[model samples]
Target chain A: MTFLSASLEQSPSTAEEEAYLYLQRGLRLCRYKPGDRLIPEEIAAEIGMSRMPVREAFRRLAAEGLVTLRPNRGCIVAGLTLDEIYETFEIRSVLEGLAVRLAVPKMDADAFLDLERLLDRMERAGQTGSSDWVVRHQEFHALIYTLSGRPNLIRKINALHVVIEPYMRFWFDYVDKPLSAREEHERLIRAFAQGDALHADQIMQEHILGTAPLLAEFASPVRR
Target chain B: MTFLSASLEQSPSTAEEEAYLYLQRGLRLCRYKPGDRLIPEEIAAEIGMSRMPVREAFRRLAAEGLVTLRPNRGCIVAGLTLDEIYETFEIRSVLEGLAVRLAVPKMDADAFLDLERLLDRMERAGQTGSSDWVVRHQEFHALIYTLSGRPNLIRKINALHVVIEPYMRFWFDYVDKPLSAREEHERLIRAFAQGDALHADQIMQEHILGTAPLLAEFASPVRR
Candidate 1:
């Protein structure tokens, strides 16, 4: 399958932005595994771009903690250790809980409908064992943050999510039962519909933390 | 004043680590104000180092959101806006609250004594109107995190503190009354002594959030 979508390729911007997005997509899709060296020339060639833009993308990704740049060595994808995974989810629970509490009181009927539609999409994707399920699940959470009226909080939450995405993918693949995903989403939707902000907050905290143990089991020691 | 202490200068490591600590100290002391362009050669000359180490320091600082590295141009100190100030404190409250709850149950008698000593130092610094008050105050909070036995959480809390340090300096300067600082510490200490983890958590959350309004009033629009 092609890494770059036609729409992303056709968008107007500097080469750096395109390259950054290209590399980000590849990382998200696990096209580049953790500790894998990223050679700028090869990436630039694959995307029909120059090495300069790809090099710039490497620096940007490094800044975001997605990659590490060694002095004499090239850039490599960053890995999360067991402790780091627990740390990431611990923060995620609090931040996402705050988002739910802030969003529920302000959510209107249309917002509820949007969440329902996204939940439906996630359910279908899960039943079919489609990779797009994770994408839809992220959108569902992102929608809740967008309704909260705090763009800064959303940015911070998204950053934490990006760092943990690969491990999350690992968890999804190794775990046989995908049944909990749908049930949890349904419970959250019900809490939102009832206008129970506190309950929704608690559910979010538990939902995020519930996966911690399973993910921790799969985490390997991070390579320095 | 000399930017680097004798110990820091004499310590063994790569040029990059030394340069990073030097720049971090400068930023913390407000030697480099927000929006000030950082010239690698000038910093290198001041520290008796080369431009390469200074350049690496810039990249590390940028990763921490402490500086902005503009393409084609040089790096500049990053400024916080009103919204960012509020957001930082919001997250700080939650994380610090978590720290207090986690630390209080595990704190030993020696830990309590250390906290008391730090509080005493802070009180003295406040009464004398010494600039070292913030340093002591940060140490007091850091001690609490250290006692919690969670190094990862401490690192995350410290990262948030670094981003907000300059604005905190602004807040400390513009507000003359330091009485609240002492009183708040006393209350937190009392809660810890009583072994009331939940109460300590609440006090921490309130203490951090209480300063948000005053700091928000002093924040300027971030320079693009």
Candidate 2:
């Protein structure tokens, strides 16, 4: 509610945070389309602020892979080429698989069962088949990351998450079948519960990257 | 030269890029130390610009991992932890390993000679033992990314490059000798000439994580 603000009136810390908030909201709502011109004055006006903080927000968003900085050309709203998307997911699949591998030795029975609860919640969320549910499903996987105890790895994984946001949005736009994604999650949960790191790694890797691009052609020049 | 300006002029693009340049310079000089405060007026004043453009630059820098957004606190210069350094180098080592592996099969004799020339230049640079030469030596390694022929991978690799800057500076500060790093470069160039992917990867992996607070007793806190 707070950090993920819909408006920019009063962010807790500084003008920069407020600036970042407006842009984050814009990105989440698909208001700032891929390859859109991101004018500071426009964003600042939208958030009922000046250009100061919004400029700051743009910086973090760039780091998050939502914006690009080029010479001659300034910042543009960033989109993943199909190649970048594939690369991002492939790298993430291995890293998450690594996380899952690390988590196995540390996972207790309760943690296994807790994940089941998340799966069920995701299933329930899927009944509405809302974008909200997809986000919740993403969070469920993030919980698995928490068990791994590697903040360093987690940061890189988060970067990948940001990189693919738009394509994920497009995927949900066309795909009416929620059951497939949910099914994938259920299968992944089962693999994790068995404490089979190799299988779990392979399963999760496929679950994250294999299916994501197949839902649509991410690398097509038209998307660029 | 235009990008080097600290002042934000009346023009929008000029102002915005000037802002970016300010932070970039600040980062280069370590003026914005990890955890340093980022006040809009302060930045604007120092850059000889209005708060608006400086705000814009802050956003860009935050995205680049040069600054941290503190919710209500505004922007603070971002800091790199030792753990982050390790994880970053680990990922870079893997990606670069992948890069050179891809490049190795396709490396023409001319390219092999090019790699040798780069190494020789670096060795000559290393013999002079100037920090500036060492920095350029680092750039010689970076040119390998472009040879990989994957723009997306290069961007990711470059992102990794920015993330490691502060820590690498710390590393240069600590190491008593520069010759060993240069010698490793020579060995690496030879490995690349032989099309030795495994050996190149091995040397690179060591070359990167070599900064691992390997000597446990030497793991002192990074004093501000």
Candidate 3:
């Protein structure tokens, strides 16, 4: 079910970068829950690095909105409210829509093959109910942005993704229907194959916006 | 031609906040050029604060993309290349467009009055060729985002504005027809007055995208 190995190939060049990556991965994987305070000395001990790098990483993560640094208290992972989650998704819908529109004409056969392969991997992961499914799912969308050749746009989109990842993790855990994403992504791939930029853009927008109600449902009192 | 008074009433609370505001104002006013190295000791001395607060300000500015933090080297003002400029404007267009659309339905007479007053200030600044013109122009646009009532959306828009402000300083310094912005603002105001969200959105998008060519021309070899 794993499309690519779970391991990231790029090694950290410095202790700071290493700490940043370690904390970033932890945040993305939901190992650190929102509002959880990050202790520099403890993290440094766990990662076999000094507190300096961990402190620097905290500053960087704080800038990225993954955490907030209090004036006196240490950094804490940012918790999203329901309204914040909707706003994040709304911004994503437009940015990802623009990415798809820009990417459609630029996509070649090799890009299509890569997307198909990722889709297949996603489907398999869904059937097996593996955690890798979420990873591949994100990759599939990221690949579209990569083809758009807009690194700044991709960077902004990815920032929004990081902020929303925790809510998405909630959705995956509590939501009943897990297999819907495969069908939605299938429509997106079909639009890409047809070379319909507008259609692809619409599909991507709907695909992102569709998550709002599900997330809202998850946040509702009944679900709690 | 003068709009409202040029004074910002909100004073900095902490030495760190004061230092951050001081450096931010300097950068936006073009007091420090791109790639200019910031010396914490010198700035602290100049601002009559301790170097500790100034150093902390550098970290904050670096997080905001106003400065780059090198490994051994001190922080330097970020320089934008031609590609970065265009990418920044492109992202701003869509985000601002969304903001206008959201704000249009929420608009009231008081909001229009506030916008008109800001526009008046901007027009005066345009006529007098005052530096405050740029400040007011930014405020006029920011007012629209404030009316959107989406704080996260406004935050993203403001972040992009910070990144693009230096390039705008370039455009104002080099470009000949500075009055064109006044005319564009007039059109946007008319659209806002009519409560035409679609028209306002389209105008906002075009208004932002229209600057690309002018900025590109400003960056061209002939100008240099």
Candidate 4:
């Protein structure tokens, strides 16, 4: 989407964009693990494109901090240390908190209704134990943040979400606990409903920061 | 700098890297203003390079949000709205505050001395009304934040600083005020010397956030 649209000189139909989107989705979905080598030739064959576009996509992902390009070893999935991951959560907490605070003044009754509806869908997806739950959950938060009217701040926050999405997916798929964020979502919505910007900001920060330790504890064993 | 080192596929001597450094320094130093058109051919001629590498450098800068690329209008320096500029300062406030908090535990007596020395250089530069003051001012803050041991966080903060740097330069050049941040910075160092992380963080956040209104007030007339 608009994240790196500036880098796409051609239309969305271009091979490089296609490769980028594909790899980005794979990474977000946890299909690509940290430290995994990305073979351009193999991806090219799978996508029915040449190696050049795939390599170009690698370079793009490298710039985005999604992958690392070693001098002689080619591109590898970018790995974050536990502390780095914690720092990322810390960064996101303040940023998303800022987003919530900014979004409060802009929120209308219709916006509140929209958030509730998204929360309903997210809860339903969670009850069903469908992987659709994660998508809806992300959509729910993103909807609120998008109203902040700060594109640059939102962009940085979204990039942070992308970096940790795989860990989130890992936690959901591997952990045995039931999805229990419905209550947290309800409280956040209530905060917004009350038009308590500071309260919402604080809730948003703690909600995000609270997850870092849990994710780190659960995902450490499998992180390569 | 490590800001966009991942985008440089070749050695530092490459034409593209040279163009990038040239443009970046120009942007950072206020030689390039908001809404300025970047003509690759003209820049190439000026730098004794082909237009291709200059264009490549433009693409990189576009990705970094320093410039915007239009369909037919080529590249122009990115111009932020007053609100966006305010938000940028807000984001920097929280981030740099976090950096100070994290850096506190890691800070040593030697680090405090280093910060004082940089402050001395910055104050002397300010007293002389030397433009070198801005560089040393940046260096002073950067040194404190770098000790946070969070490269990702520091990089994001640095990028924000770059975006607002020209405005800072404009304020210093066009406004009629003595460079009077010496006392404020001395207080920050005092906070650090006392090992007061929370106080330091609060001071850092306020220090950064306080700049937005002044910069917006001063630069509004000059902005296109």
Looking at chain B only, the TM-scores across the models are: 0.81, 0.80, 0.78, 0.83
Which consecutive 10 residues in model 1 chain A have the weakest lDDT in total?
Answer: A1-10
TM-score of each: 0.79, 0.73, 0.83, 0.84
Q: lDDT score, residue A134, model 1?
A: 63
- The share of true interface contacts that also appear in candidate 4 amounts to 0.37
CA lDDT, candidate 2, residue A5: 21
Clashes of each: 0, 17, 2, 0
> Across residues B127-209, which tens digit of lDDT does each residue of candidate 2 receive?
43367566556556656666767666666676666555555555556655544576677777778778897688678767765
- Record all residue pairs in model 4 with backbone atoms less than 3 Å apart, i.e. clashing: none
Interface RMSD of 1: 3.4
Across A128-188, the per-residue lDDT of candidate 3 in tens digits comes to: 2356776777688778888988878887887776666666666667675544567788898
In model 1, where do residues sit more than 4 Å from their true spots?
A1-27, A31-62, A68-77, A124-129, A178-180, A190-196, A219-224, B1-27, B31-59, B69-76, B124-129, B190-196, B220-224
Q: What is the lDDT of residue B111 in candidate 1?
A: 93
Candidates 1 and 3 compared: the better one by DockQ is 3
Tens-digit lDDT track of model 4 for A1-224: 22333343344566766898889888887778888999999999988999877876775577678898765578889877788789899999888888999899899999888999888887676543356776677778878888888888877876777787777667877765444467778888998888999899889888888878888887685476
Q: Which candidate has the highest DockQ of all?
A: 3
Q: Give the candidate number with the greatest lDDT.
A: 4
For residues A163-195, could you state the per-residue lDDT of candidate 1 as single tens digits? Answer: 777776666676665456677888898999898
Residue pairs in candidate 3 whose N, alpha carbon or C atoms collide under 3 angstroms: B1-B124, B3-B121
